[model samples]
Target: MNVAAIETVPLFEYLEFEFLLEYDVFAPCDRGRTRVHEPPELFQGFLHCYYEDVYGTRPVTRELQKPLVWFSCGFDRPPSRDAVDRFLTDLEHVVDDVFDHLVE
Candidate 1:
């Protein structure tokens, strides 16, 4: 049987940080809730994972921790898996719109 293959694109090639920052969907932290990472940054990370075809907080977190990934994304260091997970959870209510916006 012949094997099929797909090409891989370099991470962040067409995905500029400024582009992700253009979307202002993330809501401000509620009175009792506190966020360790900035909303835009986390959302950018979320989108980065999407474009790179990476899924889940664990893999995303790992991908983000690559030596220069954080610096390139404007973070001093990558956020923990827990932080990524929390960011994902927090966006559950509005994530569909966010994805729709990306499509458009």
Candidate 2:
């Protein structure tokens, strides 16, 4: 995902309160059933996610416009690599998207 695109959303909306959760999508995987890997800071800012759902109408599919409240405010702590991988793996939904139109 593009970092500049992620920064377009207003971060202040998420600064002191909770953001609303909207929709989700299942993403595609590698031949070995590998999962998407994202850096900790990737989860820190406004970003879009792509999910390739092998079981859905199509593969490498995506959901968009969902919002998430990052827990990094307390500390500069990032989610463990394993946890991040797992989250990406199980991301059968979109927390948000700034690119594509989000369809349920």
Candidate 3:
């Protein structure tokens, strides 16, 4: 899937898109100063843009342009920083795998 490939593009190539993933404090699920609540499965946040690649004439085009994110936790009750870090790291790997498909 293109989603898996976005990360596969060499780090140099990825510089083309303006990648912006942030922990938004203003989303509905974001608690002001308390614990961040779990977003419903279908909740659409900034993260939704990433999957647009799945539905495109050229999925690779969408994957390269779209930004990926995980916006659930907040400063008050943030998810483990390491967990988020690892998720993104894994995502990068998946992107690489997906990229491999593109070349072949």
Q: Which candidate achieves the best TM-score against the true structure? A: 1
| Regions of model 2 farther than 4 Å from truth | 1-76, 93-104
> Can you write out model 1's per-residue Cα lDDT over 6-90, one digit (the tens) per residue?
1112343454334433434444555656656776667666666676789987899998796455555556678988888877886
Residue 12 error for model 2, in Å?
6.9
In order, candidate lDDTs are 0.63, 0.31, 0.31
Among all windows of ten consecutive residues in candidate 1, which has the lowest summed lDDT?
1-10
> lDDT of candidate 3?
0.31
lDDT of 2: 0.31
Candidate 1, superposed: residue stretches over 4 Å from native: 1-33, 100-104
TM-score of 1: 0.62
TM-score of 2: 0.27
Q: For model 1, what is the alpha-carbon lDDT of residue 5? A: 15
